[model samples]
Target: MPHDDVTTPSVTTEQNNQEVLDVFGKHRDLASLPVTENDMPIGLINRAIFMSQMSKPYHRELYNRKSCIAFMDKEPLVVDAAMSIEALTFKAVEYGEKALADGFIIARDGRFLGIGHGLQLMRVVADMQAEKNRQIMHSIDYASTIQRSMLRPSREALARTLDDAGLVWEPRDVVGGDFYHFAAFEDGWFAALADCTGHGVPGAFLTLISSSILTQAIEQRGPRDPGALLMAVNRGIKQMLGQLDGNDETPGSNDGMDAAFFWFDNASRRLAFAGAKSALFVLQPGDEEGEIVDGERMGVGYVDTDLDFTWQNRFVQTQPGSVVFVTTDGLIDQIGGPKEIAFGKRRIRETIRGSRHASAARINEAVLDQYRAWQGHHRRRDDLTFFCFRVQ
Candidate 1:
């Protein structure tokens, strides 16, 4: 509650001691009365102290007739009316034990408002903190449910779609910016991994928009050509976000995504890939090191409408035992290790070579284990996602 609601008696500095005593007599519960000048508090007079002074021999005779200011404490605890209960409690503690016992005065615009009890402020702050924590926990639980709904795919459907596959997805928060999508097309199969502009709730919202655009692009244009599919999705994202006319001088919404898309052909044993500032790694059978299929350097949304922003597709002929891996930059960009450096693309390549003969699931686990070992006790810097598939 605001201090205005707890107003108590106030006296002027010119008022005599008897007048202040009369105020205490009328209101038996009053502990302290503020002595004011021009509506501003100048001091405070405690009832017990005043009564003790009066009980002394000739104390009343020596000073009863003088102004109450003589008996008032010149330095008193004062706070603003607009101050929050939590802040007031902190201020009360800073004034030490004696000031807290006497209570503190509240003022607004240099005028007296009321007095607040330190104990009362503590109780209110405790109750508010409890309620706030409860509300936050409830909201996080709801968000986790929604995020799972968007991310998880059926196990049977996943098995039917690929000969062997592994996936690792870890969000920096309960809800995150990184997400993946997969669908079976008439000609082949399409899969995509994306990292939206930010993290947590804001980034999670962009993932929804990007996912919707991607699904629409695949349904309308089909996923036969990876480059064309990405181009169409980029246009759709720009139009949906109203960034078609964006430029360097007056750019449209700066929010967009970095994504990698893959189309696998069952009949030809071929993989077609396109990306927006993302990359794909291929480890062919008998090769000691994996190779990177670099995607387009530009990201999806901030490109100028007048410029030709065409994405190019890269195709690789896969053998029966070839492995293809796609991942967001989160893994390579994470900061940790003895040198406190990024995990880097070099480490990723080495991990793939080391786990070349393992099953897809084992390979995924191995990579994750290496990443965790590199990070040690450091907190994750961003969301992490990886997708791997072995050709039949």
Candidate 2:
């Protein structure tokens, strides 16, 4: 809103020094007085400038009886009453130091309106910016709460579902693209970790949608076969996004997820795995190196439009003390360290081999610590998620 209420003292150009001095004495708080002819402003008289002139030797005797016009500033900052506060502020700045300290005059349709104080206008702009910042922070905090709720579960319930499991989930922002899910089915347990396409709010939305689809696939179709579960999830995602009948002519929507899913059988001591552009790491006890099993080179909904969607499952015969680790690309793609290169798959393999005999909890901690040390002062490039479990 434009401010229009200005009632600063004004004097006629013909007003004598005695009359102007009387007006100044009554106002006391005014920094400047506008000198007008009729109802239009002709000039401005700064109180300090007038007082300094009066203090000069022989000056009062020379001009005390003359018209106030002799001491008034011939050119003053005069702004329109309808001018926006932003424009008024810029106009005020053009007057240099004096306009900021002594204030300026505002007129409406060539008639004197009021005075605008520089300090008061600045305060209004500052308050408005502060309020906007507060609102944005509030919205981000609320989104963080919602994202946390989707991943958090009771410790007792999680422990009962998996024999021994550890997770490292870190988001670059309050809400991010990485997410993990675990569920117990009829024959065994199923777990998954995924990295959605972007980060922050856009990626968070995709994570929610992908997680919900994965949950429904598990509940309705069961987790007996890892490959079938992933295929069902892919179809569900394609259908939901209306990409089932997409063709080469259609522009691709760069929305999908890279994920790994595993079904653990407690009775047979076997694990079945299926992935979409992700991988699984296995470390046998006492081994100096671990093996990496790569998944199909295709993302869930990012498959080629001309080709058929087919995923293959891999089976692992787990020993009692073996460890299995699954992760999103964020862990290996992070850039830092002395070389300023990516952490890479080789570092991950070495970390797992060193902790082959350690418990899942210890291995998870060790791997995350090494990652942080390697990252050093580099900014995070993406969301990270790692899930590790010990074979019972």
Candidate 3:
């Protein structure tokens, strides 16, 4: 450690206590002094302890003839000059609480180099940590850009499948685990909204895996059945995460997603839907109540879930003005409000049902406005996603 305020205050064991006290007087900022024999360090002497004892009446006279070895610490923290700051910090704690305040001797090949100050060591460590954080944040921001480009190009394609639509995708963090999928195969199109487990980087990783796997499954299975598509995705997630039954490599790999998927068939003018612990809301023209078609209770690809567990499909016949809505738990399960209750499926149904006469954009706006107001000062619990469309 180098400091402009301090120079090496090294003394010899042959020197008397009075001479060591004179060294402290020369360097008022010095916290501790190294006591050495030849060029090798033997012990450390704290200035505070030595000064307090010497300040007593007749003590300086009594100790003037005594060797400095009498006041020097027999065992002090000694560190290699080339040692990393991180390793040295652990060594300092192990040496005892006094090691930081008293400082350590920086030695090269068992010979004293200089005194290492605790304050300077801490400053270097702090600067290193700050730089590391800045690099991580920069990488995540670039990742956010890539994720957006990957997700957003298919709005025009979806517009052809549905009459009118509005979508909301808000991650609690800047980047999150929630994502929506769109693909076209043969005559019609497919759309899905997925909420993977966890949040931030871990969750963002799943969105990539789930979205890519879902696309591959569509190509192989022909995009006619929503349930089969979901099954393939479930298996794909398990295979990707190494969560298959016989695999013991990743014992802690309990990860998956809750999703609502749709296959819009232009031939039959019908929409087939499947969900993994998800639900869809439908509000038809002139209907007093909107319908909530709940999907299977199980989620996709968790370690505990059965591989053979089948996801069932619900068919909703499309009409010219019928509206469909789907939401992830982040929206319905947000913890806020005066009572801190979940916004709930009941509120969603009420919002959509009340706005049955309005356009998809207007209804979506109303829902978001209500949701934000309800969220108030509470931190978001998870990534929020919601999507809705009017039939052609």
Best by lDDT: 3
Worst 10 residues of 1 by lDDT: 244-253
Which regions of candidate 2 are displaced past 4 Å?
A: 2-123, 154-157, 242-253, 303-308
Which residue pairs collide in model 3, if any? Answer: none
* lDDT digits (tens) for residues 1-392 of candidate 2: 23436556789878887677888889998778889999998888988899888779998788888999988988888888888877777787777877778677788899987776667667876787788879977887788788888888523345777667888888888889998887775577888888988998888888888888987887788876777777877887676666656444435765778889888887897988988899999887666677788889888875442125777889988888888999899999999999999999888888877877778888888889889999999999999899888887
Which candidate, 1 or 3, would have the higher TM-score against the true structure? 3
Model 3's alpha-carbon lDDT is 0.86
User: How accurate locally, in lDDT, is each candidate?
Assistant: 0.82, 0.81, 0.86
Which residues of candidate 3, in runs, are more than 4 Å off?
1-7, 159-163, 184-187, 266-269
Clash pairs (backbone) in predicted model 1? none
Q: Order the numbered candidates by lDDT, best leading.
A: 3, 1, 2
What TM-score should be assigned to candidate 2? 0.73
The count of backbone overlaps in candidate 3 is 0
Weakest ten-residue segment in model 2 by summed lDDT: 301-310
Error of 1 at 1 (Å): 1.5
Candidate No. with top TM-score:
3
Which lDDT tens digits does candidate 1 get at residues 1-392? 44435457899987898788789889898778888999998888987998888779997888877899987988899888888777777777888885667778888888987877656676787789899978986887687777768766623345678768988888888788998888775567888888988998788888878888887887888877778877877787777676766334435467778889888888897888999899999999988776889998888765453224788889999998898888898998999899999999888888888988888888888889999999999999999999988888
